[model samples]
Target: MKIAVLGTGGGARSHIAKLLELGHEVAVGTRDPQATLARTEPDMMGNPPFRQFLAEHPGVTLLTFGEAAATADGPVINGIDGHNAVAALTPIAGALADKTLIDYAVPFVYQHDSEHPWPTPWGVMPKLDPCDTDSLGERIQRALPDTKVVKSFVTQEQATVVDPQSVGDGDHTMFVAGDHADAKRRATELLKSYGWRDVLDLGPLVCARGMEMYAHLHSAIGFGLGQQFGGHFGIKVVR
Candidate 1:
């Protein structure tokens, strides 16, 4: 599968690394081609761990946002944060028409303070003003009516999403919500490729509200447990 990951943050990097590990043709999408090349080339060549990882798995190509989206096969995953996701994907909107889009985003506004160790306040942190009521995924779908937007992996931590083994706990589940069954199936396959063992389809895009709220609870748990506590929770099924 040819996958396009759009963004420059940890989320985008993690997805790129995971997709490469899964032996998928990956193209990183960024607004600035030269900047993306400059940023990723060093890590691909200089960073020992990244270099080793790439050496083990070749075929990951970095491209500008437009090129990546224009060339990708099937679904394209949006790894950018809520704040920049729309703008970053706007250029590729036409290309993304009628394509499945796996929207992975959390409404998290970073509020850092030296005196206060926490990155955000106790309540829910609003990353995108538009996501306060409706989620970014829904907004993206609204923007590109032809594009199938399926929301998933928003609740899981970046480390957990990339390297689930690092958690050392039980299977970490990811929730997906989208109206289209075909799009959901595509997302399920992609998530499985990324080592997601358990995934629950929470009906349709409207269910994303609950999923986003669940992320808030997860964040609260992380804050309460402190930074050192790095583990995820999963729901077990008994038949």
Candidate 2:
């Protein structure tokens, strides 16, 4: 299966690496291919620039949003940060129509950058807009009503995409929510392919509200772990 993962963040890299590990043809979609490759420094997430990742994985192709989605012919993983996901995808709705779009975004607005949080790797987690009333998943589904949107992988750490055993303690849980059953099924299979052992579907795309809300907890964990901690931890469901 060919997959296109959107964005240049840590999540995107994780997805690309994991998809490659799963033997699926993978490409990355960025808003500006040139700017992404020209970056000289690491990103806010502390991950190396796109140029470095591309060098390491020469087999994977890179393209703009439309080209990545249209060329995929398979699932498109929205690996972008939650806040900018809608805008990034809105223009490519035509390419996503009738396609199973796995939404792995969290609606987080990074704050304290201008106010100067002292050049941290990234900004602290602030409540996202529309999160109180609507979720990123619902927002995407509404924007691309013709697309089959499945909300998933939002609750897990990106590293777990390839190393699920490292997720919490010994095979925890992941959640999937979407109005489209087939989309959820595809998302489930994708998760399983990436070594996710336990994934629970939380019903319709709207249920993403609860999943997104979990971001607060995730943020707290990140803060508690400090900036030096690697981005591989995940929350586990006892059940």
Candidate 3:
């Protein structure tokens, strides 16, 4: 399958690498392919430039967001920055029509004045907009009525998400929720390819509120575990 990974960030890179290893052709999307490839320094997240990544992994194509989506043969992974995702994706809705879009973005508002700020090692924690009342997944589905949107991979770091066996011996649970049953199945199939044995279908895209809202808790747990940065852990829903 030719998969379109729509970002050049660390999370998107993880999916791209894993997809390539899975024997799928990958085309990465970015706001500006030239700018992304021209970067000599690391990104804010410390991930190397896209050109370096492409150098290490040959055969990967880098294209504009619209071009990448239009070329994908199957599922599209939405890894665009959470806050900017809707605006970036809306213009390319036609290319995504009728395709299963696995969106794992958390809507974070980085610049906000919180009366009671939750400070983290990096800075104050970013607040989630459209948080409890609505979610990023629902918003994307609304914006792209023709796309089958599945909310997933938001609960863990993308690295852990693509390699479940790295934590708890692959015993942890992954969740997927979407209005489209076939889209959820496609997401589950991708998760299985990632070695996830227990994927919980939480039913309905509304459940994405919980998944996206869990970002703070995820950060809290990371802090508690003394992991000041990207948390390398997973949660299991044991019945």
**Candidate 1 versus the native: TM-score?**
0.79
For candidate 2, the per-residue lDDT at 87 reads 88
**Tens-digit lDDT string for candidate 3 (127-194):** 99988899999999999999999999999999999999999899999999999999999999999999
Residue-wise C-alpha lDDT for candidate 2, range 163-201, written one tens digit per residue? 787755536788999998988899898888777778888
Q: Pick the candidate with the highest lDDT.
A: 3
lDDT of 1 by residue, 1-239 (tens): 78888765656667877777777788777677665444434342143333343455477665777788877886788877776677667667888988888888765455523353544544324343444578777877887788889998777766577665555453656778999999999999877766677788889898877676666567567666664232354433333
TM-score of 3: 0.99
Report every candidate's CA lDDT. Answer: 0.70, 0.81, 0.94
Deviating ranges (above 4 Å) for candidate 3 = none
Inter-residue clash pairs, candidate 3:
none
